[model samples]
Target: MRKVLDPFSLGMWAMILLVITITATLGVWFNTERRNSNPDRRQSFWQTKNPQRRRKSAYVRLALDSFLQKGNFFCGASVEHDPNANLASKILAFGFGFFILITVSAYVANLAAFLTRSEFQSVTTVNEAIRKGYTLCAHPVVENELRSQLPNAKFFFHENGKEFIGMLKDYDDKKCEALVIGWEDTSTDIDFLSMLCERSLVFTDSVLAEISMGFPIRPSLSAGFSYWMYYGQKFEDINIPNLKEKYSPTEALDSQCVIQLSELSLQSADEYAMITVQNMYFPLVFFAVCALIGIILQCIYAFSSNRRSLIGRVSQLDLTTTGTTARKDRFLMRRRSRMKSRDGTQDDGRFRDSRIEATEE
Candidate 1:
């Protein structure tokens, strides 16, 4: 089995599983960060310290954290006076929250649309096609099987490759609804159809009939061939329908279901320019721009606040210096007046003594 099927290994599947695991891990991390970023919902040190004030029921706490806090996963926390985090931290938290919200919402929406399209566009069997009013187109080989299965069904028949291409063109032009060729034939011509119609054509998982072919072999090689054939049949028995499903075109397409950010095309068929950013990235860019603006505004606010504080301190210092100088000036003027009064008293005393001596003589 390894010798036969080693070329087509399950490495891709393993890689896909790894990717899914990583995506799930990142999603969990984002959710946790979003929760922790919320000031109201965030588990505080105080909450741990004051266990008596904590809510009794974990479920009630979760409900309050999710809803009553008036904060959205995208908008971050809306608590009035959260003392734990600062402005920069808050901005970063909100930015990351918004980024995650936008990214996750896009992923979920695209996934939903892809699933809906896959389900809505699929024709699992011929009866489903008929019920859905889809007209079947088939090559001459499968005509008998289709006729027997869908006797009253509307269908278009194509003789060869040329006719098949013509019928596909009609289908592309909306003249015909669906093509009901054999799975092998469809797989061979699918690339051509995609080249012609791009994504307008999609193949369904309906089989009109299964065909088995026989090859001639020499007697000498027949025995070995038969032995291998028996083992191959046994392998088929073990794998069965699961093998068919694993390689089905529908499942292959579903595996590639994702929203691509942008296409690197030289030209665009639309009115927009060729090299334009896809809509999915716009929200992220907008948020980043907003964060930059917030940082700038925060810096401006800090600078203005510091400037005002410095001016106030300078004014207070000037007022103090001016008051001290005025007090010193007043003290000096009072001392000079006192000195003049003392000198005048001394001069008057001398004059009185002289007058008394002259009168006695």
Candidate 2:
């Protein structure tokens, strides 16, 4: 592994970030939801002392819903109050959606690259080859440097680089898993023959050392060798397959597994690909599971909405009943008081008339 990711993949990272964004988005959304529902303005305190809020949330359900669609099902709503919170939520939701889109596109690209990568050999570095415990061949001079640089790695030293070439020819031996040589090593036909026929062999990316060379030759010979002293060509084009033809055109090259793969491809090309239940079993099952989750979330939301509606209706009904009862009680009390005052006035007049009659007698 080049460098291990703390979390497995980009998709997982996106999910983690999206969850946090949705949590905040839902908070604002619920507030705006209640604000829009109420005819009058109200306040809710998040403090510990006054924890009872006018509107509440099903936090776990909101988290699941947020994981699916930026909490659009759970949080996207019209706002009547606190425009700033609503605006922030909208920004977060848009960014959340865009981030998911980018991540999914990247995954598709990676899949395409993976399909094409099978044609090429996996590149390795000097450290990686040593770590893999493959025998590496180099000149004796670089031996001490390599040992000091990578104390744990073992190596093979070949002075003339022929023994290394001989080991490569003995494919069964598998002695020279890698080679470390200079550019001048391939200055002649014999020098280039070491790797000329080795199809899959490659040089690792690690550079052990660098050396400047000056090949001495006569002026007449130097006229033919302008760039490289003798051959004029130091190295061929990066396309290694052409090297086989460039060196030995008459010789038949190995097909490796290309012929076998082609036969296999042709065998399957004519067969009608079937879409049996088995082919779609897992995918359909996954879709059904998702549908079930959506149904459950919707049901939870609906039940919560209906319960709040019922509570509001019941509260209004109680208030109306209480007000009507209070009005009726006040009316009866006033009527009784008026009757008592009128009876007292009539009694006083009667008492006065009786006293006048007594005086006359």
Candidate 3:
């Protein structure tokens, strides 16, 4: 069972990630500045001077939260914004908003078909698989052609392709990574068709080899034309290789895996599904990393603010004590000076009295 977000493609999810990242990063620039029109304080958003990390991170969280539709993206973190930055941020928000709106509306309106299940992001072509060093499995009968087509891939061989497909569960195991088999449409058995539609196996249109019906056509046929050149019974137009719908009725094919894959594809075309969290691994992880950074910076800022306040309080106490001590010392000096002067005057008076008595005698 797919989750809520499986409807959106990986690329869509990637776009969402890109938008959020840009929004968050740009939001930080707008949020951290002091909102002064003074060009020195406000220039480009990329200014390198006193970039307050904690404040910006808080804004980062808000900017991302806006995409989650919690707040207005254009003005979420901006209580007051610098003129230039405010304009730029609004423009960015509008641009992202437009992109997401169009994409989301198209899906919601059913203009585009939503995926029924989460598709694994693996190699789309045999060439791509070869380049990525994938091990390919094939029957020994077609081993030569496969080797030629996939010149570089590692190979695992089994006598019967059906046995291998059954044993390895449609080439999903690590031992035999992938399989390449061939059969004629006229002789395509029910069992063979069922194997091709295994829910575990995804079909890519990449053709390693196409065995021509060996029936030659006239000179009207051009060279380098693929087997898709074969026309339908009427031969009115080129045929599309959509085999699933053509063979949707598989009553004889009682394979649970095949039935499930077929049913899922059919139902997904008409059903409404939300994107799953599993499909959104990248963006979520990115958000998590940003939030963590914000938290760390916040802690650092709190500690620094506390330390500054503490130092200021200690300095204030010192200043008050110093002033009080100076006043006390000045008062003591003035009292001592007055006492010395008074004592001198008294001594002189005593001296004059003694002199006067002696002269009288």
Per-model TM against the reference: 0.35, 0.37, 0.33
Over all chains combined, what TM-score does candidate 1 have? 0.35
Error of 1 at 47 (Å): 22
Backbone collision tally, model 2: 0
Stretches of candidate 3 exceeding 4 Å from the true structure: 1-117, 160-173, 183-188, 192-199, 214-361
User: 272 in model 1: Cα distance from truth in Å?
Assistant: 28
lDDT of 3 by residue, 212-261 (tens): 45546665665434444654423655344455446555556654544333
Over the stretch 252-317, how does candidate 2's per-residue lDDT look in tens digits?
334332212233344434332222334334433443454345445445665777899888775778
Candidate 2 regions exceeding 4 Å error are 1-31, 34-103, 114-133, 138-167, 187-199, 205-361
| Superposition-based RMSD of candidate 2 using all C-alpha atoms, in angstroms | 15.9
lDDT of each: 0.50, 0.48, 0.54
User: Lowest lDDT 10-mer window, candidate 3?
Assistant: 73-82
Could you list the CA RMSD of all candidates, in the order they appear? 19.4, 15.9, 16.7
Best by TM-score: 2
For 166-213, candidate 1 gives per-residue lDDT tens digits of: 667666777657776554445434355454345444444455667775
**Pick by lDDT: 1 or 3, better one:** 3
